[model samples]
Target chain A: MITHRVSLFVAVVIACAFLLFDRAEATIFERARQAAADALSPVFEVVSGPVSAVRDFLADIQGYLAVHEENARLRMENAELLAAQAQARDLRRRNERFAALLNVQVDPTIEYATGRVVADDGGPFRRTLVVNVGNNDGIGRGQAVVDEHGLVGRIVGTGGHSARILLVTDLNSRVPVYVEPGRRRAILSGDNSDMLRLEYLESDDGLLPGYEVVTTGEGGLIPPGIPVGIVAGELNGIWRVRSQTSFDSIDFVRVLRFDFPQQIEIPPPSLPGQFIGVEVTPSDSEIITTPPATTDDEPARNESDDTNVAQPPSEEG
Target chain B: MEAGYRRGLGSRIARGPAIMVPVLVTLLCVVATVMPYGSLQGIPLAPMFPLAAIYFFVLTRPTLMTPLGIFAIGLTQDLITGGPIGLWILVYEAAFVVTSMQRVFFVGRPAGEAWLGFIFVVSLSAAIIWSLASMFYQTAIPLVPIIGQMMVTALVYPLLAWVFTFVLPEREGGA
Candidate 1:
């Protein structure tokens, strides 16, 4: 009994030491965490199989039940989308012409590696998920993860066969977002709740409930123009955003492989009357070049020049 | 000679289950706790199934689930959940020690009394974890999900206890 009591006391002390000393930013601890995750990835994958099968079965039944109403809704949505598609095409052509005339660079198309979520750390304190795609699948830390809906989270740690996603609703999550229609910039912060808080909005003018919010891509860690969520409501005088990506039903996700652009020096025009029409650098060309489509079996190659692949930006608060 | 050989083989087989069953069931509970139940909406947090197992084993077969074993289970949960490393360790260890101390009160009592004791354990665990996590993050963690998790864990404890008793009927009286 004494031995048992002493062991339990020692365990408590060890746990306290770990809690106090293990910093999240420590390299050793991070690697150890990722290694542990890799070791358990296969088990998580196997365990999630039956759960996925049951979910699919229930979904099929629900779909069958709601087939008629869903079909009608889809038909109406399709008709509206057809009209919107034509308008969008015309707008895209005009926008491209304007961009070329202005010499404004277009954002690169983001290629993503898809994976299934095998584990969900759903609790009050931290919100995260373990995805099956990892370093082997070209998934890296700081990559943005999205479901069929919109911005879900970003990769925080990666192992050989698994990666951890820090969800948007986590307390530590801070996303720089642009609130439309005014394009008002604000930091979307999470408080470990369903709704995300909008921090540092300069003016609330025209920032009503139901306004759209999206990534500004100011830091370049995340790609620009990914839909995040809509402004939900104001609480305690703080505006909140309802994430488009539903946390409850996140099954599969795509980890985007986006490389931020590096600064390039442009040379002066040598001869007189030489119209130096905005010297497009190599990086600019790389950004404009369309990458080949890749399937699940084929990982997309990083298209940026070796020297120009910028380091991931520091996380914003 | 044939009868003696059969007796030896039977003892060997029995020993295997005696050692492996509790650990396997506990591991299964850990896996079930973290499994992605995306379709199961309305409940935001998964119940602490492993905790239920710990409570049950600590009360019924204390020798099988040593302090070291419980610590390992807690570490596995922390690693899998991607939470703080020692968060669940402390929680589970505290639960183990407290449950072990109160084993006398629960040993021969009715199943309802054991369940009430489990409710106390779950509440204590929830308090410890919520406090530790809040302190670790340097912010006040929300209480709603913790309360929900506590309620779910307490509600499911009797079911797991029943299952354990049904599986290990002989050992049920060993506490």
Candidate 2:
């Protein structure tokens, strides 16, 4: 009877594991995962501080020694930036009004919480970071994270004082984006590299290299128009976005304080019963454009459909 | 007599579950999980605790790595990796099965043999994971990184094995 019970126990464990894998619904395990993260994140926070301090101490030493050359370079760049800022101010007045006329609600005000990157997942299989800002600092999950250049990632997990930023290179990273005025829709998926792969592009979208990719704000997860990356490479029919933010070079990061416009309606969360589409909810006050759905008989809208469609202003709050 | 008792207790303490496996596996996972820029960092280091533990068990005490333990480790990797659900569990299960069959080769084998066996295991482990992941995602994964990581895992294998020897007897049960 004991042997039989052990057999039953093993069988039950395996059965529960395999049976619990309901593809469509959120797994019982997802809750467990969140709980586990909550429990362990505190410990992780404690553990990571010393590691980050060591890195910072070393980096400071390096930066201190290179200060002169760096200062000279920064001076030259500052002058150029000043000149550009003047030019941008002139253009902004004309563009802002034109944007206003177009009823384009470009993101006007953005607040940021500067956070030091405490820990990084530098493994072969995953890429992520623990940032110092969390719920206490008003950092919300799904906020856009950026550095000096542009898009870094979206925050996925939040703790009391620290949050995990899922970088663009993580395997699970995906953002909805529309190519400039034409608004070609594609999913940007991260595959553990500096370059994110643009998957599920419509055939004949004419996505030439060097075209800019921006958030479409279709999903309230990210706002539109914060520079993402240029279409860096198209090899073997695969297009990749060379992220504007140097993911590898991130030291300190800023979490944008933006809320999803609560206007966009989303599908209600259904219990995990069977296979279901991920519930895509548009945060209200978020107006987003979508490509017309494809039908079998309809030839997909040509590339011209996306051409001349001006992108909306998007920056993570 | 006291010294003899102390030695016995010391070995027992060394073999304690709370001290050994968790330390090894968690250290590896934590380091690997927090490893930023594995591809860009020319250091060629990827945390290899899972490989390390599997090798230690397969070579020393195959029974230690039960299916449930392997499953748990794989599940941990899945959660940490943020990949599709059943991925790492399946790969780990496959590794566990393969390791069981190859247990004899390492018995009385030199450290070099153990090293070779680890290279074999880590290579096979990487290949299985890479190929299965491609099938799952239906996308071509860059094989070079996996291969590169596997080599690093192999290089680090000896040191970890050396560490394990301080606890797990070089000759099984010799303690």
Candidate 3:
């Protein structure tokens, strides 16, 4: 009896000591945490591989069972998507022309690499997942991760061959977003739940249920206009985001290398009789004799020339 | 003769299933945690199988399952799950100490009594873990999920306890 009590007391002391030490040298402790994760990832992979295979097999069986219903749903979705695609193409062409007219370059084009989700932070306290790609694949801190649907999260920590993603539903995640159609800006924060809380809305102006929410790129951390989710329910003045990405079965994800737009540059205006799109350089006589046609829609030659030289205002407002 | 008996007994234990069985079963419980079981609204419903195993072994065979072994199990769980470190270690060790102190009432009792005791222990364990998590994260986590996990862990205790007893039958001499 005495021995048992002594051992129990000793164990309690040791546990408390670990907690104290953890709080004292948090950096060293975090390094140890990373090391431990790196060591255990291989074991997790070996165990989860067969389990994932079984799950895939079971999902396949369930898919076959719902084949007819799924086919009908897909057919309906495909039609709508095709129509949307055609409209999107036309809008994109117009957007490009507008961009060229203003001489404002588009946001830096993002590149991506794929990775497999090998392990997850299975505890309810944290919402993080470990993927099999890391610095080797050019995945670094703050890179956005997404699936076919929408944003999952961003990279928080990286190991050599693995990286940790803070899911959008984690307590620490705060994404600046714009509520579309109205374009009201808000912060999408996670509280370790399925739904994310939308905060900091200027007045909830034009905000409603089912309003589209996308990243605003306010801090230049995430690229603007990536679809996040729609505005969801409200309780006690807290609004939620119904994320488009399915967290239950995130098997593969793309890590986007999104470099936020830094600065805007505008070129000097072309000389009269030197059309912007025309390839040929006109001779001196052609320049002297040709008339300057500055219509009302197009400002006079002097002002329009200065307008082309001036940089457009920043997109923050 | 005493020395010879001691040596023979030690060698017998080394060759026996005492160490490997409990450790392997506990390790299996750890692996069961990360298995790809379906979840409830994104929260996994897999019962805390390791907690069940720990309660059973700590109650049944305290001598074989040492405090260090318990610490290792909890630390491994914390590490793999990416939770705040020392969280499970503290919980598991506390459970170990509580069960060990109350072993007299629990040991060799009817299965129903064991299950009942497990309900109490796991509920207490869940409370400790939840409170620790809330403190660590400095926010009040919803209690619904914690309660859900506790109920599931308690419900699965009987099946896992039966497995433990079936695999390793009671010996003539006990801890």
Q: What residue runs in model 1 are displaced by over 4 Å at the alpha carbon? A: A24-27, A56-93, A269-317, B1-17, B39-45, B166-175
lDDT of 3 at A79: 95
- For model 1, residues A37-89, the per-residue Cα lDDT tens digits are 89988998998888877766776787799899989978976896798789879
Better of 2 and 3 by lDDT: 3
- All models, RMSD in angstroms: 8.3, 10.5, 10.4
lDDT to native, each model: 0.76, 0.62, 0.71
DockQ of each: 0.51, 0.22, 0.38
Summarize candidate 2's per-residue lDDT along A146-262 as a digit string, tens digits: 888878887876766767787877676777666653667777778776778887775436667667788765444566677788787787878988875655446788999876543
List where candidate 2 sits over 4 angstroms from the true fold. A1-22, A49-87, A96-108, A112-126, A132-137, A159-162, A178-187, A198-211, A263-317, B1-38, B41-44, B63-65, B138-140, B167-174
Query: Best by DockQ, which number?
Result: 1
B40-150: candidate 3 lDDT, tens digit per residue: 575656688888898888777666677777877887777666667788888888788778767889776788998888888888887898898887667887666677777
lDDT of 3 by residue, A262-301 (tens): 3223222433323233333333222212232211111112
> Considering only N, C-alpha and C atoms within 3 Å, which residue pairs clash in candidate 1?
none
The structural similarity of chain B in model 2 to the true chain B, as TM-score, is: 0.75
TM-score of chain A by itself in each prediction: 0.76, 0.61, 0.71
Per-candidate TM equals 0.81, 0.68, 0.78
- Show where candidate 3 strays beyond 4 Å: A1-7, A20-27, A53-90, A106-108, A259-317, B1-21, B165-175
Q: Rank the candidates by TM-score, best first.
A: 1, 3, 2
Model 1, residue B81: distance off in Å is 1.3
